[model samples]
Target: MNHETKRDVFEGLVEELANAYIALDGEGIGEELTNEEKQAYMKDYDAALPDDLPVIPELIGKYLIMRKHDRGDLVQALDEGTSFLLDGTQWESVQDWFWFSDVKDSVDTFARAWVLGVWRVEETGEIVKLEEEK
Candidate 1:
């Protein structure tokens, strides 16, 4: 999908998740959900997604990773191309991936690959660059 279309679909999925979360239990007078119960609700929401929308794996993975690491800012930064995740080898391969390949005038390494920046976290929890944006 194109950037705008992909973003619209993602937003729709997010809205669905949000609505499901709120509807899991009607707003209570005093009974609040425990953390575990909240997680269980999210799991159910995930399981209930229709099987036909398999492309949503990336969106779900992104959300789960960011949530696990408490990295909302990082997600925004990555979206803005201010951060990078792949190493040189992986970056080269990704240029062939549809996300880049489907873009207008996007180039592969055979000519000059347009690097899409994403942040990489090392084992030491250090954020590092995968490539310089050309």
Candidate 2:
């Protein structure tokens, strides 16, 4: 997909996420949210529908969609070396992520790219690619 299209999807996801976050924060879920709750909330708010389109709302969901196929359990696809569709274009740190304001927003960009099924592994060992739905 083109850059503008990817960006649009990412922005939409961010808006959905923002709304969900507000809802959870309003419900005080964040104060004592379990891992399942967090994950569910994340999916509910952030997960794109089957289509590669994001819901366009007042605000967009802005978070990281980490590399799916990684050596970590957070991303099962990466761990198993399987290709998955992003549905939308953006990803947050699905497994483990820490937020720091000092560095460049590479993490953010990476997340966005993740949604678009774009990722770069420092070392070339196995191959991960994007395959659109048939």
Leading candidate by lDDT: 2
Q: Candidate 1, residues 38-91: lDDT per residue as tens digits?
A: 676555545342222212123222432433345345334234432335322223
Model 1 segments more than 4 A misplaced: 1-47, 54-70, 73-78, 81-99, 103-134
> 89, model 1: CA deviation in Å?
5.8
Give the C-alpha miss distance for residue 37 in model 2, angstroms: 55
Model 1 clash pairs are 83-118, 84-118, 84-119, 85-118
Per-residue lDDT tens digits for candidate 2, residues 31-85, read 4446886676555544433333222111111222223323233244223323233
* CA error at residue 69 for candidate 1, angstroms: 2.2
- At residue 66, candidate 2 shows an lDDT of 29
